[model samples]
Target: MWSQLTKKSVWFIGILFLSLNAYAGHHGMKKDIVDVAAGNENFSTLVAAVKAAGLVDTLKGDGPFTVFAPTNDAFAKLPEGTVEMLLKPENKDKLVAILTYHVVAGKVMAADVVKLSQAETVQGGTAMIKVMDGRVMIDNATVTGTDIKASNGVIHVIDTVLMPK
Candidate 1:
């Protein structure tokens, strides 16, 4: 019964995704990093956190930035209550640090990402990179999608949310 409900939910979500695309704000043309995430249902959790952290305007601003955005499912993988705790007003600084850790100063496409071994994040930490079986891994998270262009920068989807030291 549980499995059946889960399957039905997945099917509903798939249909919703298709409908969402028709009204997506990010579309084929110009959209900033914030817009790109906001327009994508997969990144809804990320968008909420960005807004909560007060980094929405910074990400929406001009100049290239590369963001390895973790999907909603990725956020869900964190310890229970972790997301709720991070969303608290008192945890703003900590949340900002974690979010910034996912961003790089310049736009790095998938092609360029593969050639490098590591890259520094905006949070003043380095993200370790490794390639195994022709797949790029950042820290322990694999890059799922790359070079999702935005007016201000680019976004690459990752399977895990990176934590900053």
Candidate 2:
């Protein structure tokens, strides 16, 4: 009777431990940059562009990337048919270039971003960073939101879709 009681107690403890670990792991897991963006309705256009450009995997991959993400409204601000043109199959290269232009190769939070004059983009172009009238600007876009944490990196919301020169 003692042996059977001990075995059952041990099994119950083991199951409880495993269950707790699983719960903690699931809740503690932070979503990656792509997942963060995909989960937000404000980034729908940006997410669609990332998917259309075949960049979902690269953005979701490991390693910190700083993305100055434009919202759907920003995409709407573009000339009529511009976003549609960019999403076309034949314009994949252009779309990729444009998308990558928004990403820097490392995780740069808002504090660090304000100190920089320029950042080299993943697309190999330099983005001009400036602070004017107490607001941060990345190229012509205004940094409306900052320090959005993600598993892979960080995202700073911008008011315009940055175009690579």
Candidate 3:
């Protein structure tokens, strides 16, 4: 009877270990940049933009893309009509341009970003990065969170939405 009890205890402990491991790995991004945006509550506008641009699948693809995701509060920083205007069908191209501006081709971490003067965005141009006094600034936005790991890419949360010139 003692042997049987020991076996049961061992099995219970094994199951407990597996459960803890699963929970620890829960926030790991599996669907790449798109999934990062989808899973984050602050990035609802970004998710919607990806869906609108029909780039959800592409962003979810096996690309080590780096995305500077903006929160809904970031979108609100735009002019009163800006968000509404961009959402209109007539502004699809413009919206796509702005959204793409936030993406960089490779997985760049905040530590690496501070060393570069500028990095090319997926929007076809480069953005200036400034690191001073331990604060990392990307153009007009401030880096709120860094090195958020995802399955296909990495995510950095920004306080303001970036716009192309």
Q: What is the TM-score of each candidate against the true structure?
A: 0.82, 0.86, 0.81
Quote the positional error of residue 11 for candidate 2 in Å.
12
Q: By lDDT, who's the top model here?
A: 2
Pairs with backbone N, CA or C atoms under 3 Å apart (clashes), candidate 2: none
Deviation from native of the Cα of residue 70 in model 3, angstroms: 0.9
What is residue 98's positional error in candidate 2, in angstroms? Answer: 0.3
lDDT (10s digit) by residue, model 2, range 1-165: 999999999999999999998987787567999999999999999999999999999998886899999999999999999999999999999999999999999899999999999999999999999999999999999999999998889999999999998
- The residue ranges of model 3 lying beyond 4 angstroms of the native Cα positions read 1-29
CA lDDT of 57 in candidate 3?
Answer: 80
lDDT of 1: 0.93
Can you list the residue pairs that collide in candidate 3?
29-151
The alpha-carbon deviation from the true structure for residue 126 of candidate 1, after best TM-score superposition, in angstroms, is 0.3
- In terms of TM-score, the best-performing candidate is 2
lDDT of 1 at 86: 99
- Tell me how many clashing residue pairs each candidate has: 0, 0, 1
Provide the lowest-lDDT 10-residue window in model 3.
27-36
Q: Please give the CA lDDT of all the candidate structures.
A: 0.93, 0.95, 0.85
